[model samples]
Target chain A: MDEAAIHGILSRLLMAGTLPGSVKLGEHRLAEIFGVSRERIRKVLHRLGHERLLEIVKNRGAFTIEPDLREGRVVYEARRILESGMAAHLADNLTEAQIARLRQHVDAEADALRSGDQPTWLRLSAEFHFLLAEMTENPIVQRQAHELISRTLMLVKRYETTAGSACGCEEHRAIFRALAARERGKAVKAMHSHLSLVETRLRPTICVEEGPSLEEVIAHEIAVYREANGAALMAAG
Target chain B: MDEAAIHGILSRLLMAGTLPGSVKLGEHRLAEIFGVSRERIRKVLHRLGHERLLEIVKNRGAFTIEPDLREGRVVYEARRILESGMAAHLADNLTEAQIARLRQHVDAEADALRSGDQPTWLRLSAEFHFLLAEMTENPIVQRQAHELISRTLMLVKRYETTAGSACGCEEHRAIFRALAARERGKAVKAMHSHLSLVETRLRPTICVEEGPSLEEVIAHEIAVYREANGAALMAAG
Candidate 1:
């Protein structure tokens, strides 16, 4: 329905970073973009608002979400658990077809990177694990993997990529190698390390400009860094 | 809010086998139970349909999910990947507090078992590891634990208590001991083995009688499970 269409456009916008943070987003703009009705856009906006992906201001319009520190950690916490589980399953019964699909995906990512299409590369790189989860032939795992991927996406967008080289083809290469060897333990370890390395590559910091504090949203992400870097960050803000 | 309430009741019915597959759940009956209207019940039904926890027939009604052979394997495949990652994280930071919490969860399950509260015991046993995921101090791990827990709940409900005791409390206690002893490597191994054991406990041969297959209602228990099981059982189911 209209909701699905809205999801398509909003997801694309999210990926493109066209609508980030607390910018006002009118339904009319979305309607015009997709040649849809304002009513349809509103429906999708409401759905996204409920999921915390969009902030809907009363009498205003939808805006992007920005999680505080703690919430950011929640994003990573979810990714770590889900991704590692996915890696282990991939260890169990990896098929040549699945490997081929993954290879194709990585190849596409490399091509994207070479073309300097960072967005496509970023999406493909992030989706590689989900593609792996799908191959595992487990809906439960796939579902969990799906949720983690969404959360991770949000977290990555929030921090914006300070380290810059977020795409590590070698990391994917190492993961596939372990899988090829049928070394389940090693693969799981590599996956865990890969996620950590990927996360670390994004400097665990955000510059909050002069504005109303977003303490609640960021609490989950910042809980760990508080009493250490929190004070300075707040002072600077 | 009503949607959350409906999922709570639906999950209960499924896990308790009160509403087995093939049974027709009339909207009136469910609405009566929830003290809501038929219109609201219908909405809830559709939402559960989204989670794959319930299946809504064109003319019949919603029923608990029953995965076919192919879908069943997909569930396990998904869990393997998700849990493996969790196992790695657990291995990396198998702290004393976390170990204590896990042991405490196990001990409570033992007490529940001794008290002959089979349902409570079964639910708690699953929650033990899920709670363990939280102690990894990672939200990603926690969220994955939650999704995997839901699938596990569905799997256990269908296949569990068919032959074996409610849960392998002994296995949980044993794993707790390994974890408490600061044997990170062994603990991770034990966790993988524990998940494997649980997977084995599933009906090696699934026969979908008359319920909605799990993929139909994935996050059906967001309210009750979280409220009842707290963090632990929430993760397990």
Candidate 2:
């Protein structure tokens, strides 16, 4: 599989709580299931490690990193800085279509929330912020914002249990309205407040002592991967 | 050798112009010289690739990235944001000893400039900004700032010649004075202006279409690495 495909699958698993924090990734098993060499798996693992999702140890291999309280705060702090900067840029740069897309995303987020689908809701909420960053058209800021968002996902998965309104749909709508109205000050303010609400909702401390059956999780993902890409699987070999 | 040690050596060489951009790394030669396995060398290369210093190819090998004008601007933009944040924090939190260290570093920069040593001068100038970021004690910001600063070093080496005072020693002193006075506003302004000057001084379209003998350069570094670590080299294996 290509690195981006692997990255997507791994990221989804991470967000879905299938690969919980503190889980040790068995590279050999992953390689076997993915029908790829251990080297390709290692490359993917290295990329995730660089993203702070996995911690690579010498000889011991890679493990999903457990986000602690300090990291949780740091991630939010970075988000505030980057997102605030992004909101300002978006105020100046976002096109009507971009604003419309953001509104559509918020409607989807509301649907997910109303359906009580916590995972989709959470992902969409994160995506809303990421979309704002993406609209800024600054790759460097986008990359850093993505890193912060992904790491925050680890914390969210660990701490969040049920549907929460920390990143409420209404707040997202308010931020979008401000952006649509081209109110730069209001947009920045709304973004900062939204992030603050999100940060506040995170538990004071959230850590999983251990995860169950990381191997089984990998096996399940392999089945899903095969079903998703029957043709690509044959093409690779 | 450990990844950190390898990283240090490669960073020094890159900054000193010993390993120019566009130079392909010889993993086998590096493994042989370091008395480490190819796998270990690959690990280090992967780390550097993640840092954007090395561009790794699948069937091919890793090569130092040739920073373009666009990348040059992006690096400076990232620096301006991160460094300004850092200067604001440092102005409030810098200890008396930290101020002394800043003065001492600028003295070194001035000394390097006086000696007409462009490499040392360039590295020290970058180090000054890094030191400022380090004082913030925020690892996330520090890591991002360091990445930008190091990448800027690559651009400086490729584009700079004859020590044109992009990062003038007086500007470093001005920043230090602001920090020493605990003037947060002035410190941030000084940092922004300093960065602006540095960015302005870079050639508009700096690109190295070609470089000299990369193999000989790698060979020379191996000799230098061995001489510098004769004791540690024996201890490792």
Candidate 3:
């Protein structure tokens, strides 16, 4: 099996941005947590660093990266290349079961947004796309999409200009409707528009008070929102 | 500036694979050739490994991977996603200058094939797509396109696919023509057809030769391909 423990820790930490940018990750602590040898830990970190998830200096320990605007551009560009095509493929190939799953995904995203579970929303939003790619049945494309998604997450953390909300529930619902109807062209067109909105919402800055990353604020808000709304979160919103 | 040292070495190997996949590389010799520390060599090997250029292993060093049948499928899937969209983008945005450049690229590929300069042909063919992506002036899409191209090259090697001789030069020319007219739909369709040729030629094999992996093959070919092609070698094929 793959080295699940190390990868899981790295993936979660990187996704959550718990390992803040430039914050040196201590080897011993990571080893203790993962219960793996430093060698294995080093291997995984080195791999993640190569993926642009972490920055590893020779002497210094690895730290999460704070991608610049250029990188932000890269992330979006990758999305344009991958997700756009994926949207078409998904629309053309979406099964009834898949449509239900997507509805479920959108529901989760809406739930996260309603509950103010920014992290959950952010995560669910990404997973929504990732899951769509998975349905394409191409591992290579899936890997490429996953890479782009991770990079996008990293970039989102840096700039904090994600689409206006967890994923416009209405848009997801609309796309879902289009897919369910087997209208490939409509689904593809809808996907493009939806992605455009998502991309457009990702403007330049997060905030003036930007005490925390937009991710931090949104994710924490989502959690609070979740606490207040429970099932009513989406309804209340 | 980009470090030409590792890239230079790597490109040589990859281009060489287009002509011939059977090559061997020695580690100590390569370090001496590059005049770098073994550590640097290891890092480069590891990086290429991630890119699937060099199949470096814990004990077996590295080898330039020749894509078997399974890998070829992986490669083609990536092409389907990236190139199809690239063609569409090109069709929508092709300028006169861009069209001319694309023609020149096709010509160069033909010239290399005619001259039996597989390395140059290989580099040019790969760059042609990236150059088209660049014309979009979208570095983000360009970069993602780049990653896909790199992986595709590996697949070509794995499958021992002969992407065909300059016999199909007119096809490339035709695709360029469509791109120039901003026939977005036509261009996308052309790219799909073009990549289909590539996929068709790829020789599928279920065998994974039990020996030094595709990484070391990459190391040697990286060096050799560059030495053979000189300036054209600069393209990150």
Candidate 4:
């Protein structure tokens, strides 16, 4: 597999937070699993390390980040500051079409929640913030937003319950409503409160027990990745 | 000099916008000037390229970015989004000591401007934004603000006249007053308009005729750098 494909699979696996905290990822084992060389796996691992998705130790291999409440507070506060700014910008600058698009997205989130699709609801909930970032049409803001959002995903995956995120649907709507009305202060407030509420929902006492082996998780992630890219791969072939 | 010292000198020289547009930085020439190997020069050049301070063309050498009005618009818009958020954050979070520090800094700017010290006023003016970013006490926000601020410095150097920046002192006071009063909306508005005004002041027709040669500029930067680091070097030696 190409480096990007391996990186994508490993990135998803790590961000999914299925691995127990501080589980070391042996490069040789991963190379064997991906049918690639250890050097290629090492490169991807180091790239993920640089991205803050995993922690690399000297003389030791890469390990999944152990979720800490202190770090979670920092990430959530950063999001609040950034997304609040985004909310204000969109309030002033969002076009009619952009507002309409946001409306459709919020509606989709509601539908996913109503239909009892937990996974879809969770993904859409995260995408709501991403959609707002995209509306800014600013690449720099989008990148900053993406990094903070991805970090929150890891935090939420490990600390938050599914029901906690379900409640976030209303918060998203509140932010969208404020933006649609061009209420900059209200939008900023809604976004700030939404992120703060999300942070408060993190339960640090909830310890995850045994999970599937690293090999199993990597295999599942690779399969999902390949399936998503199947049509493109066929076309390329 | 070490790689970081080389990088710092080159970074400052590039951000100073004293180089002619699209000026190629020859590796061998820089190696001779810095008394470093060509490989070290190449590494610093590539690092600057990654930071968007310079552009590295494949097969060709690294070249200074040609300041474009279009790019200036994007960078300014980014600053408005980010720094506005920063202002809002500081409005809610600035402690009494931080507020006092901001007051002192604003007064310093006024003193510099009234004394007909354009250079000091200009530097203090930029530091006002940096001060607000530092107040956030969030490293992520600080980093995003720094990158946008640095890019704007490059733009301001090439596109804005000195008189335009001199007018920015009052704008800084407006932003400071709003933040000190803890008015989130007003602070955000002040920051957004301040950045917008800065952007509007950009004159695309302003063309720099000529600058010092690359070697001369590099040598001057090295001298300034060494002077600044003389104390630290003495301690180390």
**All candidates' TM-scores?**
0.73, 0.79, 0.73, 0.90
- List of chain B TM-scores, one per candidate: 0.69, 0.82, 0.69, 0.95
lDDT of 4 by residue, A1-237 (tens): 898899988887877777777898899998999999998898788778867889999789899998688999988888988898899889999999999999999999999999999899889988999899999998878988998898888889888976777789999999999999999889999999999999999988668688788788888898899898997889889
For candidate 2, write residues B9-125 as lDDT tens digits.
Answer: 776667555454566787997887667889888888877877777798978899876677678887786666557656766777889998889889988999988888876887788
**Candidate 4 or 3, higher lDDT:** 4
Give the least accurate 10-residue stretch of model 3 chain B, judged by summed lDDT: B15-24
Please rank every candidate by lDDT, starting with the best: 4, 2, 3, 1
Candidate 4: the clashing residue pairs are none
Q: B87-194 in candidate 3: lDDT tens per residue?
A: 765676677777787878887888888888876776777777778778868765776677667766666555644545344466676778788887766776677677
Superposed model 1: Cα runs more than 4 Å off: A24-43, A46-52, A55-63, A67-70, A104-120, A154-158, A204-237, B1-7, B26-29, B56-61, B67-70, B112-120, B137-144, B203-237
TM-score of 2: 0.79
lDDT at position A66, candidate 4: 87
Task: Report how far residue A19 has shifted in candidate 3, in Å.
Answer: 5.7
Chain A only: TM-score per candidate: 0.70, 0.84, 0.71, 0.95
Q: Per-residue lDDT for A106 in model 3?
A: 82
Give the range where candidate 2 chain A is weakest over 10 consecutive residues by summed lDDT: A203-212
Error of 1 at B112 (Å): 4.2
Q: Judge the docking of candidate 4 as incorrect, acceptable, medium or high.
A: medium
- Evaluate candidate 3 and give its CAPRI docking class based on DockQ: acceptable
State which candidate has the highest TM-score. Answer: 4
Q: Which stretches of candidate 2 lie over 4 Å from their true place?
A: A1-4, A35-39, A85-100, A103-118, A161-167, A170-193, A204-212, A223-237, B1-4, B15-21, B29-37, B85-120, B161-193, B204-212, B219-237
CA deviation > 4 Å runs, candidate 3: A1-4, A18-44, A56-63, A68-70, A107-119, A155-163, A203-237, B1-11, B18-41, B56-64, B94-96, B107-123, B138-140, B154-164, B204-237
